[model samples]
Target: MTFAAITGWGAAMPPNVLSNADLSTFLDTNDEWITSRTGMKERRISHVGATEMATLAAKRALACAGVDAKDVDLIVFGSCSPDEQVPNSASGVQVAIGATRAASMDLNTACTSFLYSLSTANAMIRTGVVRTAIVIGVEHISPYMDWGNRNVAVLFGDGCAAVVVQATDKEEGLLGEQLGCVADARHTLRVRGMGSGYTNSGVMLGDTEWDFDGQEIFKRAVQGMVQASQAVMQKCGVTPDDIDLVVPHQANLRIIEAVVQRAGLPMDKVMLTVQRYGNMSAATVPVALNDALVEGRVKPGALILMPAFGAGLTMCSHLVRWGDRVTPIATIPDEMPASKLSALDLVNKIRDRKSQSHEASHDGLQGARLIGAK
Candidate 1:
């Protein structure tokens, strides 16, 4: 059967870096507290919109694939931090990136979003639906973070990773994929508000809060990923020893190590970007894939396995044959420009916006009172 091959990959992160030391200043926690728990020193966060990060990554990915945005047949953007709650975020991405010819939409399965998109894209390509597709995992996790709470606050970062999947006759593209979801434990990690069902009364409750059971999430993620990885390996008729590299969701360092141990895979076989970028949710796997590709760790015919588990209690695994023979269209620089906003600057901006909105509402109410008096 024809398969979808990842022809290009790219990742983009905000200029601002929120280090463990910086986080400790606001919360009662210190760098050691975070590092021990998460194995993360810092994470990238966007001061700009989610579209900006996704667009930058998509551009680089398309450039690397040697294809223009106009040539894309489909675009699937995966994220929890969407541009708006009503309209899909992929539409905004399509307009911003000038991908008028491509069909587009957004998919959300929490951190497992990218893998879900990858499975769907592969099916579409195999069925002769689309020749070239762009799959992106973009998250503006900062806006959704509860900065006042240290638990969820320090665990997330904003970033985007884009990959170009194209149909190829060679067997070295996507080989096999397996997906599993545990709906019984859906509430283990979730955001409380901002949905059609919630806002139907038009009372305008504004932004919702993110709620998560950290310990429960950690346990579930580790268990789910381990099971999913084993299932995928079985389906592909390959053992852990046959795999050259394993790219996993960059949720926590401990989780990665746990899954590796359970799968009986050596630590050296795992690819990680959690230390530098923290948890970008759905963007984690692709970002790690891009990092490995740029470092020339991936070679043609190498068997690469990717697994992800996320908030829905969702899990997905992909078995791919690394196609290094096809030259990359472009490559990201070893270093990119930094972000313009600091974490403090971002906080100030949020405060200023809230203040201005409140003042404007007060003025409107006073104007209505004056009109009533007349």
Candidate 2:
């Protein structure tokens, strides 16, 4: 039987650090309050586009696996914030990495996009549809972010990560997974004025209003993640004791604690990047996994559990068994373009641009209206 083995992994974090102190300059919250509530001290603001970050991550991942771009058969870009909606972001990465012969796809399941893309690639590789694949979990949320809203403003960051998965005879990679969604609670977390529902609804492109019920989302996220994790473990016939590491979505520190604890796992067994990076949406799990490997936390033949929830109210948990190798086979000398702007300045620029766009489109947007829906 063929199994998809994750042979390589890499992450690209932006250079700009948006500290809580910086946020406090404009918002009513301070570092201590933010830290106490969400466990966030600082987050990143990307000076580059989402595709560029994903490209850097992909190059590093391909080099780590010592696999040439020509040999790759597939590329899956998992992100909610794509650089372009039409051409698809995966194709951009494919071209950037020179993966000429590979097929490309973009997937969005909110924060669980990376895991879902991983699952997709794994299934294809196991089914003989592809031999090698690159799976990217990336998000560029800064542009669409509503800086005026303190509730959700301080909780997100921009980042990207990629992994190389190849066909293998050994029993490794994603063994079991449970994918689900609470559609009824979908309204709990939403970014209005972004999707097709608002296309002709007099909504400005950069003008967004978030429908976030924090307490309700907390309750649902924990319940969904815990249930999914338990279900996948049972499907794979593994107990909590068998899991060597837990790489979970970093939406909130409290939620992470509650989910792991409910699954009978200790905090030390989990890999956390929330305090430093906040929630990078789809990038959360893969970036945390990359950090774990870099920190020497992942061992040979290890068992890793990844659970995540996103805005579809989408939730999932995956069980991945590692192979013998934990170190990269090679390295790529790639980096992001230099940026002289501070994090606050970059954020303010985005805010100003958004404000300008809203102002310019004010009349036209007001005239636009939903045509089909009642």
Q: Considering every candidate listed, which one attains the maximal lDDT?
A: 2
lDDT (CA) per prediction: 0.79, 0.90
lDDT of 1 by residue, 181-207 (tens): 888888888765446665655323324
Candidate 1: segments with Cα more than 4 A from true spot? 200-206, 331-339, 351-374
Query: How many clashes in each structure?
Result: 3, 0
Clashing residue pairs, candidate 2?
none
Give candidate 1's root-mean-square deviation (CA, Å). 6.2
Predicted model with the maximum TM-score: 2
Clash pairs, candidate 1, are 15-338, 15-339, 64-330
Deviation from native of the Cα of residue 326 in model 1, angstroms? 7.1
What tens digits encode model 2's per-residue C-alpha lDDT throughout 103-209?
Answer: 99999998899999999999999999999999999998887788888999999999999999999999999998999999999989888877788888777777777
